[model samples]
Every structure is written in structure tokens, then in C-alpha cells.
Target: MKRLFKSFLVCIFLVSISINFNPPSLAEPTSPYIRYWLICGPFKDADLNTECIKNEANLSPVAGQKVDGKRWRRFLSCEDKLTFEKDEVFGPYGNSVAYAYCEIYTPTARKVKLYLGSEDGLKVWLNGKNIFTNNAVRSFCFDEDKIDVQLKSGWNRLLIKVSNITKEWCLSARFIRRGDADIKDLTYRPAMLYQLPVKKVEVSSVQPTEPKNKGMYDALNAIDKDRSTRWSSEFSDPQWIILDLGKPKSVKKILLNWEAYAKNYTIEFSNDKKNWTPVYSTDIGDGGQDVINFRRPARVRYIKVTGTKRGMRFGYSLWEVQAFSLEDK
Candidate 1:
């Protein structure tokens, strides 16, 4: 009877532990894998480099829109590998092509890396510009290609054209930081609230003499899209630099990444390179990054910055200079 009672207490103890115990889970690392997309496909495409492929691959997709009788539909991919053949939108196709489109919104302009994989052949377009293409016949693998891309400050468009010669068809793509870290400030949307027609203005000329160090700290380094290099002036007050935008562009904001900053500076705009108008000025300046926004947009071809007081013992130096203009999309 004592043994039977002890067995009953043991059963009760086991049941109590089962009811109260919580198992530990080894959580998966955070990943920014794109799961939502708009897919349209089964187009007849044999050669990936032909004009027929180019015409179809460059297409901009809209949800519920029809292209060659195939309506664009929403696809939710639960797996990181987007297996189109296994999905309802596509099933067991051979020697054909398809397209996937997605939009990513960023709050700021930054450079990011794209990890992509495709079965058979693939082509990619970003913001109406063809960014990547491969005609190699291969199976789908995770992160087969790593492409560097610059994301604009607002909504950016990403389009993928995938081809399958035989068997299965699949693709995988995601955006990550330069060090392969997950991006947290991205929002996936099918449509943009509004679009900004922003393009890079070509730098026509730079003035205020060449750097004494030449290639090390040249005048062109400030706009070379490389933050590791910088343009530095001589160690003197009243140092200045001028940049010609080749043509008049509607400007609203300017970003200055400073290396050796200025305590007092004035930014001026000019149309003919001779006459200048002050757009922004500051007396108390801090180093690091400075984003200057104008009260109203200005149309100018020339931008000049003059520094009257140095923040440190060194001269005025800039790691990067960027200007932004927004127009109707």
C-alpha cells in the first residue's frame, strides 16, 4: 500500500512539472528576408540576353495589373527560398520566364548589400535601372550573388526576372547591411504614397585650387561616394570650396559629412558661377554629420562653402558632400 501511494505521488509530481515547465527555445537570428512579392509569369523566354527578354524584364509591375494576359497577384512566401514551382501562382513549368516585384521604403539614404540566388537565369532592375543579370543555368542556392546597391531616402523599386529552362524554379533575395547585419528600418509596401524623381547631378568642376597632397586629399574626394577619403583645405581661416553641378538643379537639402569641421561657415548658391547667393549659414557648428535644409528650393548650378573659423587646429575638411532635389515622379 505504501509503494502504491508513493507511485501515485510520483505521477502527480510528474504531471505538475509537465503543466508548469516551459521548454527553452534556441531562437533564430533576426533576418530581413523578403516574404511578400507580386509575381507574374510563364512567359515564353528561351534566351536571356535577347531583346524579347529585355522588353519583358524591364516591365514595371502593378498589383492586379495584366501583362500579356497574366495578372499580377500577391504572393506570400513563408520560406526564404521563393519556390515558384511549388506555389499556387506557378506550378511545374519548363523553358519559360517570370517576374517578381517588391518595394522597400527607407527613411534615409544609405548603401546596402543585396544577397540573391536564382535557378536557371536571372535579371534584376532597381528604380527602372537594370542592376544585375546572369544567364548561367544553375540551381537555386542561398546568397549565390552579392550585389552592392545604394538605396534612396524614400521608396525604392526592386524587380526580378527569373527564367527556368527545366525542372524546378526558385529565387531568393534579401537586403542586408554592409557587414551582413539585418536591416531594421525598412518597410515593405506594394505602393508608394508618393514618388520622388531624384537623380544624381553630375559635378562639372571644382575650384579653390588642388590639394597639396594630390590624390590623397584631392578636391574630387569630397564627392567621390567614398567616405574613407576626404578633401582638406590648407590650415588657414577663410578657406572655401566650390562645386559646379554642370546644370541648374532644383536643390532643397545638402548633407555634409565633416572630417575637420568649421566653426563658422556660409553655403552659397550661384547660377553663372560669378554671382552667389547665401542659402545657409551657421556660426556655431559641430562636427560629425550635418544636414542642411533650405526654407525653399533653389535652382542653381554652382554650390560654394566658405569657412571662416576652424573648429579644430586643422583646416576645413569634408568626407562627403551630397545634395538632394525632389520633383514629381
Candidate 2:
């Protein structure tokens, strides 16, 4: 019929060029998990205008976009300044408490200053003294400079520094140590409106018999005695277990079993005792019981369970270790 109608219009022009050049996998919608603090370059000094004036004058942005979120900006270049050596320590609210409320983002706007130091204890300032000191005693000192500061055009100078370093507690703080085209961004929300509800103690079964050291007896025989642990089988290596929430509590939901095996694991969160942060992670590998939901709720005393990947072993076994506060609602 005329070459079959030109072969059906060349198969409709090759199906409209394959539907406009292959476009069909679009399902990327996941945005819910914000937590930030630390609004300044915690410094020991390599001098980049004192780490760009503590990362552009203590910029604050607890969440994201909103009159520049929290505010502060003025330090452009030298690669923004982010260095840690003398033992390394960075926690501007990534963990470690002292006072909360975070969110900052200063794309532009200058005039900033704030500095703090510690090795034993710290207390800082900027608008209250440009610089205020506390017991500081680990040795790199810089406290005493509260000048005529004013930054406002899109997030100005708002300083605050606190430190506590005794032995291996190296503390460092910086802001507007210098300035130019500043860039300070931070936005974290979900402290549960400043959460404060954790007083429900009663998890004592006195069980501690399973340590033959096959990595602590496969993590104490994969949880029992009310500490809970499971995988059901399908694990090759990489296993971990550590819990000591005997004090500070205020967690939410973290129940996993992933027995059957598919692969995926990463859950780290710590307090004092050392310092670790991963929050919650999973691949769900089609195993089994897996629930990890938290959008800003954690007070932790200590928790660690590692397993980067070892699936195909079918050795997943963890039963019960439930924890919930805030009236367990």
C-alpha cells in the first residue's frame, strides 16, 4: 500500500524518537532529615584569615532558605577554610550539647567576628564581648576582643563559642577571623522542639553470658536478654554490637532484623564515651523486620552496631531491644 504507508510512518518516526530520547525513570523524591549547628570554623590555625573568620562569621541556618535561614557571611576564598589536625575535633552541634537552635546560610553580606578556645573549658562571645573566655586550658589561647561589629545585608555577625578540653579535648572556634565573599551554610531541625522527655528506666534482666569471643559470640548470640539482635542468616562478615544507654535517653524507633538477607547496613550514633554519628541507614535487602524512622529525635547515651555488607550468609538474628520515651507514644 505504498510500502505499507511508508512502513507506518517509519514506525511513527521510531516511536517519536524513542519518546523524546529515552526519558522514563524519574522517581527521586526524598527530602526529610535536617540537623545542623556549628556555625564557624573550629580552628587551631593555619591562617586563612583565621579560617575565613570562623567560616564567615558564625553563619546559622537551622533548616534551609528563609531570609538566609539563620545568617552570617563574609569570607571568600582560600577554599572556605576547613582544616583539623592537632587530634581533630569537629562538633558544632553535630553532637555534644550546650544550647540548641540551629539554621544559618549567609550567601553574601559582610562584617563578622567571633573567636573561642579551649583545652579544658570554653565560653565565647562576639556581640556580648566580641570575645568572652571561660576556664580554657589545653593551650592555644585567644580570648579578649569584642569590638564594634555589625553585619547585616543578608545574615550578619552572630557569635558564640564554647569549649571543654581536658587532656584530649582540643577545642577551637572561629568566625570572621577575616572576610571577603563569605559562605556559611547550616540547616538542621528536629530536636523535637528542644526535646526533654526521657525518664522511664526499667530494662534489667541481668543477662550477660555469651562471650566466647567469636567477635563476642557473634555479638552475644545476636541479641537476647532484652537487648535484641537478629539477621536470620545471610551475613558474611562485618558485624558489631554495643549499647550502654543506662543514662541519657530520648530515642525513638530503631528495630531491625533483616533476616533472609539482601545486604545493606549502617547505623551509628554516640555520645560522650567517644563520638560517632551516622544516625540510621539501611538497604532493606528484602530480609524481614526493618524499621528505622527518625526525623530529629535522639539524646543517646551510646549505641553502635556495624555491618557494612556481608549479606548471603543468612546469619541475621536479633530479636528484641526496644526503646521508646516521650511517654512511649
Candidate 3:
């Protein structure tokens, strides 16, 4: 009877242990890859700690300029530490001008926080707008820039320009949840967003051909679909940028993403491309981002911005000159 009791006790103990033991997890672990689109360059005589690196305006494919050996490649990072030593990344490189590193990611939550570390100067753009920028070259430290970003539900673009003033040009990035927890239960995708009608207008011209910085203040940059690139005229009044919308398309709205130059301006339209008529004029233009909607759609081929008075000592400057029609769309 004692032997039987002991056997029963052992069986009971085994069953209890089986009931308490937890099984291995069948859930898929989160990925640790930081996918990025990277491009390096061979540049010279560029400012080290400045917004110059962030703007790829003077780089290749812009203003007929090219970065001798500029090549873009897709990269996925799987390491905890990021570095650009004499051995690893674009080393033996001098002051670079046109280096670009960007990534588009979608997160489970609408809001996220990012942690970044870099050896030198870095500029970050969220949704094509400047958010955080460190235009100073210094030693690398973890969590150098901690930023909280509101991500759009579907997709968001993050553009980073890391400048290599010295030999060591490195960058590291990571995302965390609201409570500073590790990123989990998130989805990763290579983002290809649907583009709107935001691009270079077919034809753009400035009255004063030679602006303040002709290299940067090109009429082409204003329509290059880049906010960093802008068109600026001389520090004088009566400056205008004529935009030929290819052919006549309904233009009811005009968004002037200005750079604090034109305070008073008028929007003129011309159908025959010779005689022009003023549709709307703003004397109280505050000069940041002004969106002007016409009383009705203006079906014209030419649209011009004529500056009546100079806001500052500088002339008219436009970052992005865009036109859209709600009815046409």
C-alpha cells in the first residue's frame, strides 16, 4: 500500500508540474532592422555645421550639377552600434555636401519617439519639413537627439542628412513607444507614397535673372518639389516669378510657401501670355505659408507673383510655388 501511495504521489506531482509549465511562445518576434535609403558623396569646400547638407539643391541632378561619384543604395542596419570609421563607411572623405539618408516607416501607434546618435552634424526632416537639426560637429553620444513625432497612420517619411566633416561620420537611430518601451508589435514596410501634383512646373522664370545666390536661388529650385530649395530675387521690389502651367488648367488655389521675403504681392493671370490681369493681391501678407483661393477657378496658362513692396531688405523668395484647383481635381 505504501509503494502504491508513493507512485500515486509521484504521478500527481508530475501532472501538477505539467499543468504549471508554460509552453514556448509561438508569436513572431519583432524585427530589429533599421532600413534606410543611403547616399554618400565626394564633396569639397562645404560648411561642416550648417543646413547646407540637408538641402540637396546644389547636388547632382539639380542645376546641372553632379557629385562626381554619387551613388544611392538601400541599406538595412542590424547592429546595435553605428559608426563610420576609416575602415567602414564613406571614409577618407572630406567635407561632404550632398549626403542624404532617409527612411519611410509606418507604426502601429499614431505617435512615436525616436532616438538618434551621430558623430557630427545632422539634420532631420519629418514629412518633408525640418524638425530637429544639430549643425555642430561633435563626439557621438547615445540619445543625442530625442524627438517625439506624430506619425501619420499609413506612412511617414523621415529624411536625415548626416554630414562628415572629419573622417568619422556615423549615425544611429531607433524608435520607442510612448512609455519609452522597446518597439514591439509594430509593422515595417518599404514606403512608396502616392505623390500629389507637387512638382516642378513646366516653365518657371524670374524677372531678375541674377538673384542673391544664383547657385541656390534658381527659378528651377522653386518648382523642384523641394522645400529646402527656393527661388529668390535681388533685394528690390517689383520682382516676379512667371509660372507657365504647361497648358491651361483650372487654378483656384495658390499656395506660396515663402521664405520671409515678399510681404505685399499680387497674383496675376494671363491667357494669351502677353496682357495680364490681377486676380488677387495681398498687402497684409504675413509671409510664412499663405494659401490663397481665388473667388473662382482661373483658367489661364500663365500665373505670376509680382512683389509690390519688399518685406525685408531681401527681395521675393519662394520655397514652393504650388497651384491647385478643387473643382478640377
Candidate 4:
């Protein structure tokens, strides 16, 4: 009896260790659907296409926390159907917007199919990048939309925005395993009020060739934050500009506002500025506001924009070159 009791205690200890330390791994692919969410809303005006509905989309929320001066709380759905009604969660008012935040954990990095359904309109962001959106008045059904998402190893943040146009306000999401290759080790957890590490960055200087007009079209104009100003290069096929971000930063996104755009270009990053690594390359380029989001953040101090083919007869003229990190940089 003593030996049996000792063995039982040993098994209990092992289970506790696995539950605490090995939280990411699972014995089998259990009920891997998200059922709990940290939600808050009823900010009036429920237009999914409008910016008003996405005001709190980028927030890192916790249970019982206040967002935009409104209280946020954790809500659990007993059934597969999820609701974000004005009176149910945070509303007694209609024609408003609500947000739901959740986290997913994967043992390995892989692409997975996300099946989503929603009523009215919806927008979704995974790891700070907008992945899916639909602006339509409709009823909710299972798998109304399917999105292919590449989730990195460990935890991935998911933010959902649902808008109500005086009717049903709800959304549902789940992961559909892709045959046998589907990840068996997957875990879904409630997002309570956790914050991810935010990367930092500082600009040191910008290096570009003498502009067509030195003072009027200077290299510094690109970073001046004024859309009216522009940095124009000499009329040439191959033009390049390098920006030193002071210190190494985890770069995740890049935005370029082009006046005279490049038809072919590559956005590269480096530490020593000698060896360059291309994060983005384009052969068929469109002249406009170009926004690039990297699946994985790159740690670098130097960024270079090399253009080979000009969209216009003039050289590459940029109104702004903005680099963004995970958080504020």
C-alpha cells in the first residue's frame, strides 16, 4: 500500500510539472477552439470600414481594464455562437462597435486555416497585421470566411472587430486542421490583460545622393513627417537611400509614400551597412502609399531603399519613408 501511494504521488507531481512548465504542448489535438475573449465596446457608430470602429483595435487589453475610458471584461461563450450585442456585453445602445481579443499558441511555426463567421461586418488582425475583413450586412453562419495565416512558434495575438448596423452583432472563429499535416500540438488561451514586448528605434541619419534641387528636395525631407515635402533623386535608373536607425531595432513594418515611384525596388536592412538583407522586393510596383508588413520582425540598425526602374521619367521621389517596430519606436 505504501509503495502504491508513493507511485500515485510521483504521477501527480509529473502531471503538475507538465501543466505548468509545458503549457504550450498538448497530449492530443483537444478542443482547440477559442471560447473566451477579453472584450469591450459600444463606442457608437458601427461601420466596419470606418476608422471609428477600429479605435481600440490596437490595444493590449486585460480583464476589468478600462479602454478608451470604458471598462473591459472577460466573457465566455457557452455555445459555439458568440455575441457582442449592445446590451449583452457593454451595450444598452445600438449601432455600435465592439472588439474581442484572444491568443493562440503553437508548438511550431506553420500556416493554418482560420475559419470565421460574423453578422453585419467584421475585421481581424493577427499579430498587429490586418489579415481579414468584410464590410457587409449579413447573418452569421459557420465558416463564412476562410483565411490562411502563418502563426509563429509560441503565442500569436488575435484582435477581432465586429460592427452592428442595428441588427445581430456576433462573430465566430476556429482553426481547421489541414489533413494529417495539421499541427496536433495547439493551444488556445483566454487573453486577459497581457502585453507583448514593444521594440524601440531612433533615427541617426539619412544618406542620399545630391538631390535635383539640394535644399528644396533634400534627403532629410523624407523623414520630416510633412506630406507636402519630398525628397527627389537625380533622374536615373538606379537610385538608393540609406537610413541609420541609431540602434538596432526589431523592424516589423515599413511605409513609403512615393511621389515619383519605383517600378522595381528592394528594401534591405543591415547591421554594419556593408552586408544587406532584403526584407521586401518588388518587380511589379504601383505608385502610391506602399505599406509592407514583415511576418517576422528583423533586428537591424540600417535600412536601404534601392530602386532599379523608375515609374516616371523622373527619379525616385519619396514623400515619406517610415519604419515601424512592434510597438512604439
Better of 2 and 3 by lDDT: 3
Q: Which predicted model would earn the best lDDT?
A: 1
Residue-by-residue lDDT tens digits, candidate 3, 205-233:
34355456456777887777788888877
lDDT of 1: 0.75
Off by over 4 Å in 1: 1-9, 12-31, 50-58, 191-329
Q: In candidate 3, how many clashes are counted?
A: 0
User: Can you give the TM-score per candidate against the true fold?
Assistant: 0.51, 0.25, 0.41, 0.46
Model 2 global lDDT (CA atoms, 0 to 1): 0.41
Residue 152 local lDDT, model 4: 94
After superposing candidate 2, which stretches have Cα over 4 Å from the reference?
A: 1-105, 110-217, 220-242, 249-283, 286-295, 300-310, 317-329
Candidate 3 overall Cα lDDT vs. reference?
A: 0.62
Which candidate, 1 or 3, would have the higher lDDT against the true structure? 1
lDDT of 4 at 42: 70
Q: Using alpha carbons, what is the TM-score of model 3?
A: 0.41
The local distance difference test score of each candidate is 0.75, 0.41, 0.62, 0.71
What's the true lDDT of residue 289 in model 4? 93
